[model samples]
Target: MGKKKSKPAPLPQSLALPYTGVESHAHLDLPPFSSDIEEVLKRAKESGVRYICNVFLGHEAWKNNRHLFEQHDEVFFILGTHPSHVDQCTDAELGAMRAAFAEDSRLRGIGEIGLDYYWDHFPRENQKDIFIKQLHLAKELNTRVIIHSRDAAEDTIDVLETEGFVDYPVLWHCFGGDAELAERIVKNGWYLSIPGTVTYPKNEEAREALKVIPLDRMLIETDCPYLTPVPYRGKRNEPAYTVFTAECVAKELGIDTEELWTTCGNNAIRFFGL
Candidate 1:
């Protein structure tokens, strides 16, 4: 008799959404699994996270993934060229983004659109141009913004100040700056989004930065498919893992996780204008 074949090992449930809450931010477009977005989302909802703010940072996925937001009532999206993609963008592309966003109520904000000097591929001036343009568009639309700043915090803050966005709801997503920067940002009344990077043992700067962020201004994210939290580190992250980041944050504040979750969830609702 032929030997029986064992069934394929079950895929990890980490990508599945938990049943408890919502996820603040995730890049659902990148993957070894973008092709199976529906299945991934099904797992996400089954896991408990009821909604996700899917950030688009350029790719074929951006063009094709619009349907995912429409197909699922629980999903929302943001559009903009990422700092790294600034060089590849043209004026026409920016115009297109403005048009698309102007037409879609679900396309909530302009984002993933701050500065990064981490690599030299894109010139500083080019990143600034695109960043400022998108910021202006967001301001005109009276929409929220998701800023992506890495190694260019001062320049990023300068742009915001120059643009007179003193009252706009700007979220410094995946904030990893030191306490001083956090203090400055908090003074400006801007918000900070804590990612799984906050859970890493080596991110002392981010851990310290958390001290300055008041509870009302705090938001949570996974920046998923990257920055997976501990115990699940080196794995793909999803909304369910937001709870872990929330736990780390609560521990930092000496508050209970339930209180943190409720507060952060409320912050998210208000910031996203949901």
Candidate 2:
């Protein structure tokens, strides 16, 4: 064989930074890294990630897998029923989540809750009902809310505004809209969690949109095992991959990587009250 091309190095291997970056959202409890959870967590820590926020999909997942991160205090939690999974949002489940929040100090917020009009099978009415329930619960607990809206931004904002959530501790998780949408969210005093999708080549809308997101109101997240960033787009994502997102976002904003990374981490810290 002629000259062989060398494989690309992992993002973290080349990304140099202090151990202060926080992964605003992740799903390590998922099955992708079940065999090497320790390695994954260790890799994330070694990659300059200070903490990782694990979002539990529902009460059952939280009840079953919260222990996996018990020894790893750096992994905080946001538990809620996803809009698609409203079937599980029973009164018993709500009571269980409320009890869990009270019993576990690590449960920091209510999240991954809101409208997902992208999926037509799930009725909008049902999604709205459960989302309102969780919003009310978050208000009752006096905790932060992490919203997950997809293709339903108007109604989502309307519902939140009607519920008196403007200026509240709310985060629009996995934000991928245009600059106008970003500006609107900021106007409402809500934070936006930018995901790895911003690194995609064809996502010019998102890349350009990111320019308008205020530094203090922005947070970076892997949303792992889902929107893996560039150079690793075809592979499973993890908290360790947050560096690539930080890199992309920092470049897009024409700011220093370390500065953006630390600022986003601080934003998440303040949002979650960690």
lDDT (Cα, tens digit) per residue for candidate 2, span 64-173 = 89889878999999999999899999999999999999999998899899999988458999899999999999999999999999999999999999999999999999
lDDT of the candidates, in the order given: 0.79, 0.92
Off by over 4 Å in 1: 1-20, 59-61
The residue pairs in collision within model 2 are: none
Model 2: weakest 10-residue lDDT segment is: 9-18
- Native-structure RMSD, model 2: 1.3
Off by over 4 Å in 2: 1-6
The best candidate by TM-score is 2
